[model samples]
Target: MGHTTSTSVSARGRSTVPLLLVALVWSTSAVMASAQAPTSLAPAGWDAGIKLSEARDRNPDPSIVEIDLTARLADVEVAPGKIVKAWTYDGGLPGPLIRAHVGDRVIVHFTNHLPQPTTIHWHGVRVPIEMDGVPDISQPEVKGGDIFTYDFIVRDAGLYWYHPHVMSAAQVGSGLYGALLVEDPADAVGVIDEITLVLSDIGFDSKGVLESADSGGPAGMVFGREGNYILVNGKVMPTLRARSGAPQRWRIVNAAKSRYFLLDLEGQPFYVIGADGGLQERPETTETLLITPGERADVIVTPRGSSGGTLTLRAQLYNRGYGSVEYRNVEDVLTIAFSDQPTLPVQTLPAVHRDIAAPKVAGATRVDVVLTLPPAGADGKSEFRVNGVPFWKAKPYMATVGETQLWTVKNESKFAHPFHLHGFFFLPLDEKLEPIHPMAWKDTLNVPIDGTIRFLVVFDERPGMWMFHCHILDHADGGLMGHVHLGPR
Candidate 1:
């Protein structure tokens, strides 16, 4: 229970509405100007029926969440009659959900029971370097039977996650990952029926055996291996019971190794309110939400139709690169089964927004990073490069603490790459080097094939080595990774 004040939400030219208003409006219909529904929007078991198993908090302190996490091998059933020996955290696929409040201290006592050495990378979190979980850069790898402790403060209210930083492509694809949600008590998104969806995939043989990480070799590495099975919270086409026309807040995380989840709700619009770092300046609506690897989206969707009818959440084909969508078909991610109640009238949503200022870039230092894929060598192995060299042969980029830098990343390769920066959030820049509208902090952005992305970031007082790489685990493992040395001012 750290008493840190959060600036993620701001009341600018509008009233600061709290979540309690939702209950009040639904119960009495006093404060809202929209059509009222039954006090119980969802059935008794509907809200908690389709959710990931949560990690039990051991700490009694209201502000500190402590949990023990073990990485081991477990037999998880992704689909009926199909079970695979998957590498997992806490012996479960997609691991247990870790929930904490904004600015709360989280302590994870981790033990590695798996065969290989591994470390847990807190994705999209603003942790100190020592807790970053990148082997050899921030901390050493935790070998088999070894124990480690991760202690950090949740500075931002958003959906983050954790996974193995060592052998990420193999480990994460084998089911070694979980979700970390940091919530703000003052968040104005008044919807209470919220669910956190972890989107991922895994491949297995016909007899339910896990696929090899090196199954495709060089060609597989070039295109990034995708699982044959799509998963939402470790289940195949799991069904959720929802009330018709009742808004449900969805915090979605794309945890796939390389797959991009371009989600569509039968052409129905999704009200996107937040992203990787937290709530944006304002909400936007889109018929489809593209959540790339390692990305998260906070959105609201109202499932509507005849009672007892179901609506499917489908993952449409997205062209990440060549062959990504050549013969692929749409994937059914989740099935929302509506309750037997009649559809309620459409209600007007509250205008919930955040106040985030664009980073000043007038005197920011500029850095250029070119992503390229060279031809296979005599060994017939493909490798991705940054600035014309692989991470192994490249020098560390230098930056001083308290300095702001504008990075222009140009992808000259034939494939798309989800560029990710560790330990900091950046503001995506437009052509004028100015922050994009509906300003929101981001830790990862998708760089399309032969495309470019620019962003402005400042290295704060924390000085240590930080990593930057492609979120596509295969590409990163193939050498499209680098580090930055943030020297003390």
Candidate 2:
């Protein structure tokens, strides 16, 4: 899904010891007289120079984080003098960052001020059924001027995200998503410099007007609509100041409605340490990181270049289906400008490891899900199907609390689907039906076209209706979606 080419770019030699980057030395006395933000620690605001406005914690207790969230239309300038009224949460594209530590409680007082009804789905978080935010299944959609409350506990530490569940594709593509970071102080990853990146895109016409969600009709929906403009934390081609050889931990989330991200940082290797559910058993290195829609990647990178020079971080062309990359060009996601300081000595990354046991699949219940896309109907409408039937005409797959199911997801269509399951994580299996190496938990995975994906998921004691669908929101809305009942049907 990505280009595989690696080359050395370090301007100096590398060492095995950790080299702490020194603080910036300012010479201007007038600027020094004013208050100076800490330059030693990520220079106050790090990656992309687009600092996400964080949600305010209204509560006084340290263990509980509460914030008021609102979904409405706000004018946002993605580029210089290029402004558009976008659907946003709390008047910002990419919404406010919600941060909390493991075992902390999160309370979100949500209000809907948009023209349509909406609900906030906490993607990848292990919230209870009542807090899952699925309309008609967990709760009804909050209409305009309506309010709702979302309260959940952060059970795992990872990079997760949130967006509207109703009209998901349209809402998300219109830019109504935000990042949620859960931290564990006990995490063995010794790297302290980390930044949460919310990767997404939005479609707008050349005249600075938002494009119609249903722009290309059924065929467009079939191929999945991708924004013409690529974005990083809601900014277009933002700049991140970096010191060559300084390592920075990045927790990245792919929040695009359908687009996939195949990131390449000047062909440098990325030390991947974790996925959807957090740290894996061990770290692995890869030249290009392919993050499908709704997936997350935890990686460590050491920028290497000449001082005062720059490198471009590009999103290589990824072929998700027909015409995906046929005419599309590589997009510049971010610019890494090396600071004036001399390159810090390249240091060996810490030995990061976790002990994640493989899930037992002995006699697990078997479920077959086939994703299909037939020809257009008489009305000239195309519909993607799961198990030969669209969601509206399908029955819910049944399971019980404490039941384990081995799902064989076969994609018979011509496009890839990022399969996602709500409220739980699963272990992907290999051809031998064994857990993949460096076992990590995942709730979303890309099922290649005309291929199959098998995963084992245990329906824990949380009983209710959960959703399973394509993370390509357009496909899901077109019918490639279904429900799983964890209780009596």
Point out where model 1 deviates above 4 Å. 1-40, 47-49
Which pairs clash (backbone N, Cα, C closer than 3 Å) in model 1?
Answer: 1-63
TM, every model: 0.93, 0.90
Q: Assess each prediction's global lDDT (C-alpha) against the native.
A: 0.86, 0.83
The residue-level lDDT of candidate 2 at 425 comes to 87
- In model 1, state the lDDT of residue 128: 86
lDDT of 2 at 450: 84
Model 2 Cα lDDT, one tens digit per residue, 237-290:
888877788878888999999899999998988999889987776789998999
lDDT score at residue 105, model 1, on the 0-100 scale:
88
Provide the global lDDT of candidate 2 against the true structure: 0.83
- Which residue pairs come into collision in candidate 2? none
Q: What C-alpha RMSD separates each model from the true structure? A: 4.1, 10.0
Q: 372-447 in candidate 1: lDDT tens per residue? A: 9999999998789999999989899999988889999999999999999998888899887777887778899999
